[model samples]
Target: MTSQKLNTFLENNLQELKDNGLYNEIDTIQGPNGSEITINGKKLINMSSNNYLGFANDDRLKVKANEATDTYGVGAGAVRTINGTQSIHDELEAKIAEFKHTEAAVAFQSGFNCNMGAISAVMNKNDAILSDELNHASIIDGCRLSGAKVIRVKHQDMDDLRAKAKEAVESGQYEKIMYITDGVFSMDGDVAKLPEIVEIAEEFDLITYVDDAHGSGVMGKGAGTVKHFGLQDKIDFQMGTLSKAVGVVGGYVAGTQNLIDWLKVRARPFLFSTSLTPGAAAACIEAIDIMSSSTEEHERLWENGRYLKAGLKDLGFNIGDSETPITPCIIGEEKLTQRFSKRLTEEGVYAKSIVFPTVPRGTGRVRNMPSAAHTKDQLDIVLETYKKIGKELDVIS
Candidate 1:
């Protein structure tokens, strides 16, 4: 077939996405991703970023990045195994180990890559994985890549996890079993029941993996979910992102020194991809310093989350059962959800609507990410706008 014919075939398949209001358009941010941001020449109170601690645009991080770039250049120049491992990368990993209260840590290019690399590196086709139904896409992909038997348990249902874990181990058909879950569910902001999970893992001899992507800077006073449950020693894998909370770009796995060493030798990304830039590595170290020194940013973030969630609830929107700083205003239909997001942007709030495929169909939502950088006055304005939009859309009485 001709190239033009193939293009037409692809375009036809995409028509359904457009017709169902699932087609996503890219929006360019004109300024720094901060409490308030410029998009399309309009300033909006940004609520869609994962920068919960608001360190992405922090002056200290910027200064550190500049200094590191001056000292070590812009890139690491080769894959980690082939002379790409800079001193700063080692220092950053050490810093992360200290921050996570682990014996050692390994950094990857992104959180997605970390999951893809670590999970597959640890388990093989002979093993089995008991995963949360609502775990992130990265975890799902990693399990698939591992050549393991992937069994998904119900979200946060310890009973289901226990049952599946027991079945996997008792059958004795698999060489090993790993139980994995998101430390914090990104969409609903609900924390994983780590204590219960750890107990089950112990009973079944399953390796415990917790992806704390959204929990790192927002839970357990910034040490993450393992710390939140005081199960740091019990969890086998403590996966997290420097991009989201730490305000830089990278992902990490924190565990025993042996685990870190194994990953360094076996993880595909670590062996094959270039290391994180010196600037990002240095900035991430600085972020860990900030998170460890005090809880001021974390406190400010929760205060803002509570304030905004309370305001939205008072207006009668269906804010789901989110126990963390991540909040979602559940709007039923995809079109309505997108319209709601558009209205919020028009009224100067930057929260984006999430629809099917990201969540189950018909359970579309507008996810709000409150940051430490947002002042009370800014949150108040956001609340007022939400109230106005909610009333207009009949989302609230």
Candidate 2:
């Protein structure tokens, strides 16, 4: 018994999207998501995953997951404030704090929830947040949920941030001011100017929050961007995800013991949502251990990134300005971008097209995420396929 109005709205929007070539068709990946993936019985090189270190399918993490599952079953059975605060969860938080060089930490179910809970918990209608223009969707939504006056600072523009922070502070309208940004811009693969940001925050006495979802385990020898700039004690909030580089399924905020204590009591998700499973917590702990002990995988990931970027650039593809391992093969037109991605898939590569409004219109791109598990041979095949498809689609010379 669907509402007629809801049905009409859905039908019209769906039809409009299809007509405008804006509809996204999802593909199912069979088996483990690693260097290669299978879709519709076809194996293709995988380059669209966020598994930065290839830890998603690592056997060490798998073994830890299995052991924890056997010992604690599957679920935590209740919210963390209830009876779900297991010892493993405490260990995970402590590990995250130690790894991030923070005084304490609090865990959440997902990165998005971490942002939503943390932002709203500290900020209210009388507060203000200066956010980067290119911050992640989760960050945007979290700012909105906070009921704070959100000032969109230009992406990585330290001058703009300084100006906005000064204005917010002088306005005397807010009880507290905060500046939040992604430690690494995911789409552009650009690192935030943390030293400058810290300076601005210090000048304005603004609270700092860094969502290092893409930077954790990829930057600062696997600590994060804050550590990358030696600002471990400078930032107020060091937020990150276990689902990305850590290759598990949770999020956490590492900061002063006071902040963690407040979040534990105030963040709605931690109060009402079920805690992460024992398996996930243990797997995350193992991933941290592996990262702490070695830089082999980290070095491999960067080497692979450089190799692929060089190959694409030599072939005349419009690879965007990326300072990190994320490579985006930009194709201006939306329909053309979609077609190019489809051709790549057909040619044994599984890189997907990213279009508006994920990115700006006409800046459509096929983003590639090269992982540590990717061999040179597999990357060569991917490059060859990209060459074949890029020429056929007239996306490159």
Candidate 3:
């Protein structure tokens, strides 16, 4: 309980992280997150941001944010349950519901908070959750917090999911069963088999949840994965982040009006946390407008992804089975992956390396997030640098 004792414990854990080369050092970005960014006074081709549609720095979004700030001031001032729920907040939620083609929607402070709030609110101690093995950390934590018996099925293994779902339902021990997955896997860039998953859920009468954090602005013609598979009516929870593809900061859950009503009443984060600012809410509404009106950004993002992935593949680098714009250049060792990232940075690219325990051992990678903002010339530069560093590090032949 002493300060010295706490310091010693922190030091020991910090030392462990350092020894494992997993100590995350925060890098300061001096400018906007875009195709190119400034970090530590150096400019680099940025492939690390989740700004899929480049709306983070977009003029339209900026103008909306400014106008909202001017009209409504800065903060919501209190939690949503109190006086924090502004008209803009309700408008944004309605827009999200419209965009995802759901009956109702509710917004939270962050995407992570939405998962932590919504999942725990619905599935309690008596319920059971069937989660994908590779689901996001937020989902894993949410499941744990729900006090539900969480059973992680193998990633994208429908056979495993079907067997587990059938067994769980037949057992009849739990009050409710929920099946959850990320619509698009972030690291490997593979998409969830939602069509098959939905079929299995229907057969077993399971509640369906899809966290489309990376898929919202990137898939289903910008509506999301549930929309992509035409399973909007089947899914119970269609979760997404306004911060990523939408280029604003917040999270939302779109579902039946009953579900949204339950979350507004029961979700802890919604009840206890302050709502999103007027500016963020307004910017998000504008973002959805842009997403619905044009497919140019989505098309360009896929084009860039194809260009980069093809170039890396032609150079004999192992670009994993990514069906989305997220491309990972898998390097076997942690040290090599880190070294690859460092080399890329020195050569003016900013793709980050992923190592254990973010990923499994021997699956370390330099993950690339190719955005709609990236130009052909920028991608060409990244490719040339990759080839140079790959040759030097022997990552490619």
For candidate 1, what is the lDDT? 0.93
The runs of at least 3 residues in candidate 1 whose Cα sits more than 4 Å from the true structure, single-residue gaps closed, are: none
Report lDDT per candidate.
0.93, 0.94, 0.93
Model 2 lDDT at residue 88? 92
Candidate 3 Cα misplacement greater than 4 A, ranges: none
Would you list the clashing residue pairs of candidate 2? Answer: none
lDDT of 3 by residue, 1-397 (tens): 5799889999999999777767666789997888899988999999999999999999999999999999888999999989998888989989999999989999999999999999999999999999999999999999999999999999999999999999999998999999999999999999999989989998999999999999998999999888888989989999999999999898999999999999999999999998999999999999999989999998998899999999999999999899999999999788778888988999999999998889998999999999999999999999999999999998877
lDDT of 1 by residue, 1-397 (tens): 5799889888987898888988877799997899999998999999999999999999999999999999999999999999999899999999999988999999999999999999999999999999999999999999999999999899898888888888888898999999999999999999999888888888988998999999999999999989988988999999999999898899999999999999999999999999999999999999999999999999999999999899888888899999998999999899899999999999999999999899999999999999999999999999999989998998888
Candidate 2 residues lying further than 4 Å off, grouped into runs, are: none
TM-score of each: 0.98, 0.99, 0.98
Find the number of clashing residue pairs for candidate 1.
0
